[model samples]
Target: MVDLSQYLPILLFLGVALVLSSAFVFLPMIAARFTGAHKPTAEKLTEYECGFPAFEDSRSQFDVRFYLVAILFIIFDLEAAFLYPWAVSVFKLGWLAWGSMMVFIAELALGLVYAWKKGALEWE
Candidate 1:
């Protein structure tokens, strides 16, 4: 049986990481409080421009198609990312890995086809 004490090093490492990360996040805020400027002016508060007055709010609604396309790009990008590593190590991997990858590719292809059929790929 494995001893609970065997995880002491990992626990210590996690504790140290937590402390360091907390310091990294909070130290900057503390330093800013001590040294940063707190002055506010109408010019600084206004939206920046190339000498053009603002016509609309910065927070604007986007079409659903924009998010759909973005998600599709991310999905395909991740697929290629995983494919490259697997392709490099293909010779060492067994038939099971090849079969699994084939299934993954097939599922992605089906999703792409579905998206295409639904006009999700079309830009208005």
Candidate 2:
């Protein structure tokens, strides 16, 4: 039977983390109190983009193609991310995992072809 009380190292680690976080917050507050350099200017207050004055309203309409591509990218990227874990555990999971990943990739490829045919991938 393992003694649960032997977890003193974990308790010490938690205590160190708490102390470090508290110090981080406390030091910043103390420094801000002494530093009289806090000032708001027109340049600082205004939203600057690419070193140019923003000409149009930030809340402008975006193209649907942009959103479609973004969604497709996120979906496929997440699928690829999952593939990494499946690949590492392939020995344990056997041929089923490989087939499953292949199906997933095929679906993504089909989606990409469909998007291309529908002009969803075209920027112009």
Candidate 3:
């Protein structure tokens, strides 16, 4: 018999989480109904973004510069994500990890400089 007693705490935690999540999601809805605050108004339902109606086509083509910015953001964001875990354990990892991290940073720095030189950072 596989002794599943060791997994009892994990199962209990998951069960509690499920109950709390369900309560949080349903309680608000039930309270709103009972409190008479669930009335729907046309103004409340309208889009309030930019405080004006959207005049442009929703599917309009975006500029390449925006895409470039997004790609750069993702690249640097992933670098930060990788750096955090590596930073935490680099001391135990020794010189090879340190050297590799430095090389990775240098490559990213070079790419950033190249983008700067090419005016890819400019939004206008």
**What are the per-residue Cα lDDT tens digits for candidate 2 across 1-124?**
9898889999999999999999998988778768965566887877565877677997999988889989999988898799889988988998988898898889988988999899997886
Task: Give lDDT per model, in order.
Answer: 0.92, 0.87, 0.96
Clashing pairs in 1: none
Clashing pairs in 2: none
lDDT measured at residue 37 in model 3 versus the true structure, 0 to 100: 94
Give candidate 1's error at residue 47 in angstroms: 4.4
Worst 10 residues of 1 by lDDT: 32-41
User: Model 2: what TM-score?
Assistant: 0.62
Model 3, C-alpha of 122: deviation from truth (Å): 1.0
- lDDT of model 3, residue 34: 98
- lDDT, candidate 1, at 32: 68
Model 2 residue runs over 4 Å out of place are 1-39
lDDT of 3 at 6: 100
Backbone clashes for every candidate come to 0, 0, 0
Clashes of 1: 0
Error of 1 at 22 (Å): 7.0
